[model samples]
Target chain A: MKNYFSSQFKLGILGGGQLGKMMLYDTRKYDIQTYVLDPSNEAPSKVACNHFTQGSLMDYETVLNFGRKVDVLTFEIESVNIDALETLEKEGIKVYPQPSVLRNIQDKGVQKDFYKKHNIPTASYEKYAFAKAVKESPQWLDNLPFIWKSCTGGYDGKGVSVVRTASDLDTLPEVPCIAEKMIPFKNELAVIVARNVSGEVKTYPVVEMEFHPEANQVEYVICPARIDETVAQKARDIAEKVSNAFGHVGLLAVEMFQTENDEILVNEVAPRPHNSGHYSIEGSFTNQFEQHLRAILDLPLGNTDSKVASVMVNLVGDEGYTGPVKYENIEHIMGMDGVTPHIYGKKETRPFRKMGHVTIVDHNIEKARTVAEKVKGSIKVIAQ
Target chain B: MKNYFSSQFKLGILGGGQLGKMMLYDTRKYDIQTYVLDPSNEAPSKVACNHFTQGSLMDYETVLNFGRKVDVLTFEIESVNIDALETLEKEGIKVYPQPSVLRNIQDKGVQKDFYKKHNIPTASYEKYAFAKAVKESPQWLDNLPFIWKSCTGGYDGKGVSVVRTASDLDTLPEVPCIAEKMIPFKNELAVIVARNVSGEVKTYPVVEMEFHPEANQVEYVICPARIDETVAQKARDIAEKVSNAFGHVGLLAVEMFQTENDEILVNEVAPRPHNSGHYSIEGSFTNQFEQHLRAILDLPLGNTDSKVASVMVNLVGDEGYTGPVKYENIEHIMGMDGVTPHIYGKKETRPFRKMGHVTIVDHNIEKARTVAEKVKGSIKVIAQ
Candidate 1:
């Protein structure tokens, strides 16, 4: 084994957002050398890494130059320059979760096809070169009420729309995309699996996703998704299969929908640690951040058992507020039992900007869910 | 209030070590920018901070030049340049715990006198300018069966001598020191107090320290020290007085000895986060690391309640091991319930060197203690 600690070895990371910031936590714990690159000067990861370089993550030259200085290259976001990673890989630098995995995930159209080829149970979908190409087909109206998602760069309800009618098509971008048949489901759920380079694997418990009634956004994430034992086992098995299929050497978060007919349909997959695993920080035997480190380093996988049932509530900037951010009534929420707030260090917050999150863990899942609701109602991320 | 987030505000840290690495956890959480100066290149805190400047923490010019770059300064170890901090104070840089407090606690003799001046209960002691000075004074031999501790820089049983006869004097350092009446104690205890600029305060529950008989070093730190209610309250009261007397901002850890007679005696104090509080990361409602951040940043103090009883077993290199370190049976310990290991990421293994720790938390303190003992017995930090 190489003695990398306090040595010349360096780990380079692309996309210095909250995920990268949290990942830096474990690197700090192991005293691993790390350098991060981000476009924003105030990136949350800027304060916690050995070095911070201000550059575009998608710029080929910038990423290529940064990757050359590091022993291993990894990323927090999928929208990075794969060409740069490929060049770095050719030059002998290791890229975890592999650039191939990122490539498969960057395009929803290709990701769905990869799932089909691997016999993974995913929602039925059709890929089109452009929205105009789909409109040109006379029988395209037959697939009405389907979900329309852009093949690339879709995040947090942006670059995605529901085509209820011809008029809805006017709102979507004229770019390559996917049209998927909407599956009616009783609940949304997720499972996060960690796999090391040596093939050791572990899967966290399934979590339930609760969405806002109007905004259609995830309101709270509840662990131990109130489901049958058989369903949970099935979800874990499927997630493990996905991890093995991709040969992923880090965290792979698999999101799914539990249909009314008692069938599980894969929604999508993230090659790195995902937002859904945030509850594990306070609830699990081993946190996702540390697990990522173990997986990337090919160390033995840790236990993923939950110590307590938990609920996670995202803290987004309140609509119509922007400037120096204030977490209104945060102390009141802290007064509630089992509430742990995580502020992401974003100084100026605009509407819908992700400022932080709060986790509520208790012996009883229902109690945790109730506390999560109160936390969501009491605390507001607003401009000062 | 100043918006330090993503702004020009800088926080300076002295003596970068494991404690500083843990404190950086919260500093990153709040996105507070920091600069750390340590003598060693392999300091654990070197990776997870905003700035790393290699320099002597006790050198006046080195410390002063580093202090000039930050808006506020603090430390992990007490053996820092107090005069430079005083100069920085005069020049308008805020130094937490105050240089006056460090001047008192950095030396065992002055620390004992401060306790006496404040009417705080501690072991009785007599100071001598040097070993020669003590030999010249025959009256000082009256307390022959005493513990002779060097006035400064005595850590982890080093620079400390248990004197039972005149022959012991030969092994003692020829420096100014103290001879204290050693109390036969049933257990060792500690309490961590956090105070802010506005005088807000909080104290963690007293924790019991278990020592290795042969090494005379602490092995396990058990939280919610299982002691009589009256004794616990007395310990807390003495700790509060010490914090008030010091007029310090940030964490003040007061180590104590509980005599068989149930009386409590102050041993020493660390003005920053201490090893005794490591269990807080997994057991407390508000961990000590975050509390340190809140105190120095002038934020409101958090609740100091324990979520569960926790026992932390220190992982040190086994005797006769020196080279690349490997944690043997680490996976076996990870399989146990409520066991979480924290590896410090120092790749080398020297005999008795702290490499990491394992924290076991449970509703039953006795059960957690049992698991911690098993963990200590099973894992071996050895040269690879």
Candidate 2:
């Protein structure tokens, strides 16, 4: 008579950002008891959870203390205290994605090495204990223009530099890092794979990530990617392989590059609900957030089929605005059929900050893409 | 801009039942601050809302006091204090479905009278000042068999009785009532029409109600009811007419009966989210819960078109199992594709009490209906 729904079976979530807020929607739906911890008192998920503990996720004591109080511990981000997670696992607490998986993923060097050792198709790369080593021996890069990524704490295009020239290497911070051979890829794609403790696995459809040409930031995520069926299948198979290789319990979003030769190569991975799958909220039979919970809880995985074609346009804060946030033309886009805008509840807007996103769905993929473009042009996330 | 999203502009909701819990999902998506009040401290919406207050919804002081704190107030239940709502409205607080609408709907006699006065087609019914009056003048009821309903406080299958003979009248409560002429309806149907404060209105697809032969309770609600197009259209038009007649803001669920001759007659009305529209949560582009919020907030109504066919099966507590609730065979049903169970978070389950609902969606109506049947037979809400 284990009662997870509407009982004292507490499920502690490690981060309380928009991803957690979205995940809480399913937890609330199932009446599953949830406790969330975050550094900010004003986290988007601060209100929806049954319990909210304001603490640092990186602090070993804070994470361990919180983990011991819950029956199962899962996180929305990989930046948490892995040592504390290992301790919690040793003490018989259930940690989804397992501490071992997080340990490898916590640093780019370990993640890339794991990929290489497992024969995962990723760009050939060399890891440096220090960024200065690459400068000290220019031959370490092998090529003129390599992608230099900091081994730790690189997120949302930060801590990643394109060494187009020798001076570009001088601009890089002196830290342990990896230099990946640049691939002239045609498109960036992502596949979210869900695996449970019992080993049941499922993968969502391939989604193409369209980047802002100038900023090189992902702007639109279109599901049922406008790629060849074989390519889509290849990407999904690769993602499932990654999930199996990691023995991950929960959602693992595998980002990949579709090389010019039609070959798919792994770019990186996020072991949580990813932005690329946000379209699932309105488009898929089972949303990624809910699927993540089902996987971690070992509940039966839901259907990952898309009910409609969709495109998700991220509502990054307008460059010139900062202060109280205002979603200009939000009502206008909401007037469009099948357009849903998800506001992350952040009060103030800063330049290029992730403020919210809009999902446009339609039976016709082209039509959905067109509406998504229109939504992108109309809505402006600016401060009032 | 008032900045309702993530701002101090609060939405006060009365009655924190499953309906309120479902509405809170949308509020979370929009990041709208909400405050919910319910009598029980273990209300389903308690966890999701920004603030929760424990109080009797029908109390004048409680309703008035809660109403004063928020810019806009709405109730998911019809049993709230109409007098207090009127007072609040006069004191500058906005209450959707104004107190006048509730006053008309709070009594069966008044509601029926209003339906007749508005030229709405409905079964002919004779109202009596008391049950004794009907017993005294049996000839007033031309037919021997008719439906008996209490003038006030009747909900679900309660406070209503079927009178077949003089002996049947004796079993009735001695109170003000009405006897409706039994139409021998071919099917029971419901249409949820949403109207915004700006007078814009929309009607959801007609849903057929399949009542349990023994309990006489709604067993399943099948959307896009298996009826002729013109009949469905007629039902929808009638529903829209009812919504316009009431001039109500928010959702008004219009229950109707299709006569042997295919005439659609008004059965009753609920000026809030109703059980019949529950299937829309997974079927329609805009779920009824979200539509209700949009209507109350004067936001543009979303597309009510069905993205996929769906049928909803109620998960009522099994008779003779009245204690802590347990959803037996829940995992078996969850394993089925496109099956979604919504646990209502009611810790204690009484006989025939609504514990939750399961929605089955598929491209084919017949397939969804079949899965819904399997779901009904498989999952049991029993005492642990």
Candidate 3:
């Protein structure tokens, strides 16, 4: 209803990272003006957005001032100043995936508690105020090899560890944490759910995440998870339930675990586009970024069906390489059919840093998976 | 090989219109630095490019200066100053779709001459120094229904006319022009050929341009061209011959006329991305913009096969209104399955001004065409 296309409307975005950079592509397609705020001047989204402000997303006044200049406000990350978002909402500025939804998901303990309160199926967990308390309690010691996750400020595998023995407790951080029962899982799966302002909701196909055997990092994300029809349906149903419980606008990516008995348990959820859905860029009829924009704008959602099977492999920096980044054999992999590499433009390449991703699409899922493995083996993100 | 991805390599572009704006998306995906030069500060590519220089692309000094700042140079429009491109090439700047190729295609007369010299099939045409010369010649008087086209500086349906009567000559511009014998044709089609610097060549599938019955404007561009396979192969073969003859190092869109007898004759050619290939954005394995980048960068080209059937409908401003632009019913059309609207970011709307385009993709060509018609009928570009 608002003249958002090629008009005077401005959409302000917090956190100018890769997600913001990808989102800017869709904004550009619609010719919608956008302003981005990030701490780094060299942020990936700096060039693509209409205006880029170098500021902290966590600073209250900074975000508040930024939000005042736009018609609608949104964020690509969850580490923003929630107080500023609440103040902006009070001042009548539209902020999607409302601040309350973010507040509930930001802290691990609170997120798990919300899942329980909403009758969402999740792994059993015990909360503690501090790691010392967990170590002193006999109950936690009895459950050896449990999952230890910090209640706050954890990201990208940080502040999370598998406590195999009591010695692992000594390495834990002195912060509020959650000790979760580690159930043996057959596969790690995820589903991305989109909810519009009008309450219209849709969920992408369940994607199966294949992790590296040694690194414990996700190596490939395959869409239409190779599972029984009933299992996939159950996953989508649970993901929709999670989205309905949150009543969040925009995209909600729900990560779940399919146990040996085929029961789907919620692992966690991201309030924005997740790596699990990156394959949608080339595989699905509507990409997650564009769908997120449509949902946030309250426009009708696009088709969620896949035009082709797709597998996405992350291009992380090789070990012992920590300098200016270089993509070796990228051209070779590109020469292969249906392979597309998306470099994030980070410039530097520290070990295990996510520099980019490559998507392999084919009419057959098995062929796509094979090409994905070839892509992963052929291209190396290394130092120059 | 030159570390163009997220490195020090800089790519310069002339004429920052919609083509450059779309190309910038691929550049951003690779983290390639870019500089764009256009006469308007409101150029669509002004925000997406790394550097924006407001200057005349036709001014030799201005183009030369802009070209000197980047490691490689290209143009979205062929109207750029060729002398500057020649100088840049001499100065060791990599210019794709070489200046010689552009020179051969920039003028209609010269382009026709090249086709004749190469034994390419085309409509017979007689060159004239001025409109009076065309009128004074007895041979022209016999062909009352011939088409009149200006030799140079013609674009967007300007500098062209259908001389149905002797009195129609009075309205023609007194410039170097050509009187082309209009051949009866069954269809207007196009093929996009991409050639890298290494001489590796590939051609996209043929696309048919369906004109409006009354307005005579192009209404839809259908991919795979609903024609016999033999005809499509013939069109692609002819397109490849054109690319090979020119030795172009980027995308060359070859427009052709399929006569009533199934004979394909070269109509014209564009040295950069063309509107006929817009459907590839959602239809083909590799979109035209990305293909252009890969060809110009001398990188391996991606597959040119179509992933699905697609039809593109242009969104031109309505005749009755002329002022600030508004896209009426855009949201309604977006609700259609597999419909994607690309707004060009132009704030004003004048009669027949190309504001944007919509791409409808489907597994079935007929269904895609049907959806395209619905999209065309539903959305209206007008002034507020």
Candidate 4:
């Protein structure tokens, strides 16, 4: 434990985004030296971490060289070069989530296959080399109005598409991909499970992910999802099973879809701290970032119980804004009871770029949700 | 704001004790580069801060030289030279708490007089320049028992004595101090008030301090003190008054006495993040550390509401332990729900040294209190 705190032990992280920036917060707390590698010079994580190295997380040599300077390796983003992690692991440096798990998760097709092999409940899907291959075989079009997801490097709706007709395929990038059967779901839910190397495990309460109808972006993440007790329990149990199967040594955010028929289908999983668990920061006993640190350090997992019902609204850049960013109405929102805005310290803004988030917690869940909606409507992250 | 974030803006902190260590948590969180000046190379804050400069906080030249390096200056320990802070303030560098407040608080006699002058409610006390002088003055000596406290550099239980009889004065330190008429109280309590340059102000819930009678150490600090609602409000009002008087631009932890008759008396105040507010890390909507940062930076102050009832138990060295430290049963205690231990990373252990603290949180305050007692009973920080 001493080795993990204020020592020469260095933890290398990939992707200096907001997640990385937040992760650096805990590392800084423990005085654990950290080196973060991201392509952007102005990455939000650059200032927070002890050492900020600007380089491609996907570049083979870049990651390998960065990995060599640290004791153990972990990542904030999954879109990293797995081969480099494997190389680091071979060289005796520990890489959490294991390169194997990242390899499976980095690709939609592989992640689906893993769920199937593990007998984990998930949506049925078929893999394709390209969009042309789907047209070649009409059988592949069994699910005509399906969800199209690029196998690799898909993030925040970039490599994802919804196909209403065959014509929708034209809008998607031609690459290795999966066409997931669009199962009608009553709600989107998530569970964050933390597991340490010493076998200590803890799961946060089920959180409901309410997505924007047009943008398909999660509008509010409400913890202690207002779902049936049995459904919530099942989702948590299934999430634990997935984490156990992956042998994850840190936080594993299990995103699931609650079908209208009450079946829980694994939507996807993110190996690092996920957006859905941001509510834990203000609402839960042990925040997800601190839990991630504890789990990775193999310390006993902390309690994940929420102290209050919470709703988290993401602060994304307003469309057409692309310069020094300003959070309008931030002061007004701060005046609201139980509202906390976490600015990621990103000076520049781009359309829909995640700059920060606001979490509203209250004893009454509905009140928190209402305030979150009001916050979503009033505040805007715009460029100066 | 960007200049404060990872720029060359260095914040020089005097005294690298636990409070300083915790303050560094926020500085690190905001990526505010900081330099810590303390006499001990193994100071608790030595690790977390960016730069650790070994120096005496009391020596004028030492403090002045250190103050010249940072953009803003502050201190955890009040024993720091006010002349140096005044010098720095005159030179255009910001010194939180202001030199005037420190000058008053540095001497216990002046502090008591200031309270009387302000017409603040406080226990009756007598000041003496030396222990012998108090023993010689039979007229000044009250028959009733009193608590003797040194005016300078006394921390924990050291330089403090309970004079029940004439023999008690024999062992007391011969230093300028105060002998206060002890008030019989159901509980000891404290309130932390935070203020900023923008005139923003906030107060944390009153916390009841449970003391170990034999050791004279605070065993647990329970937030939202299990007292009558009216008493809590009075304590908060008094705390706010004290903050206004100090004209401080940071956190002020006002220690107070709550009598069995439900009366409150001001004990003393620390103009920095105090131990009584540690539970904020786990329980409050906005932690005191972040609040202190916001106050100093003139950023919008966050909500100070508690999300759950929190109890903080200090981690001190067990009696007779004075060597390399080992936290026995740490894992066992951490295994319990809602138990969070913050090890300050101090490698050595001396009897009764304030090493770290554990925060237990629950929606049920009684349940959290019960767990805190168990935590206090089960763990031992001792010599290896």
Among the numbered candidates, top DockQ falls to: 3
DockQ of 2: 0.74
Candidate 4 docking band: acceptable
Tens digit of per-residue lDDT, candidate 1, span A145-229: 8788899998766777778886777777889998888889998999999988888888999999987664456779999899999
Q: Which DockQ values do the candidates obtain, in the order shown? A: 0.33, 0.74, 0.84, 0.32
> Whose DockQ is higher: candidate 1's or candidate 2's?
2
Model 3 residue A63 CA deviation in Å: 1.5
Model-by-model lDDT, in order?
Answer: 0.85, 0.90, 0.92, 0.84
By DockQ rank, best first, the candidates go: 3, 2, 1, 4
lDDT (Cα, tens digit) per residue for candidate 3, span B1-384: 658899999999998999999999899988899999999999999999999999999999999999999998999999999999999999999998899999899999999999999988999998999876788777778867888999998877778788898888888888999999898998999999999989999999999998766445678999989899999999999999988889999999999999999999999999999999888888888999999999999899988998899999999888888999999999999999899999988888998877899999999999999999899989999888
Question: Model 3 clash pairs?
Answer: none
- Candidate 4 chain A minimal-lDDT segment of 10 residues: A1-10
lDDT of 4 by residue, B185-222 (tens): 88789999999878899999999998877677888999
Instruction: Report lDDT (Cα) of residue A358, candidate 4.
Output: 88
Q: What is the per-residue lDDT of model 3 for residues A1-384, given as tens digits with 9 covering 90 to 100?
A: 757899888999999989999999999999999999999998999999998999999999999999999988999999999999999999999999899999999999999999999999999998998776777777768978889999989876777888988878778888899999998999999999999999889999999999876556678999879999999999999999999999999999999999999999999999998889889988888999999999999999999999889999998899999999999998899898899999998989998888889999988899999999899889999999
Instruction: Report the alpha-carbon TM-score of model 3 versus the true structure.
Output: 0.98
True contacts kept of each: 0.32, 0.72, 0.84, 0.29
Models 1 onward score TM values of 0.88, 0.98, 0.98, 0.90
Give chain B TM-scores in order: 0.97, 0.98, 0.98, 0.96
Residue B42 lDDT in candidate 2: 89
Model 1: how far residue A58 lies from native, Å:
4.1
Docking class for candidate 3? high
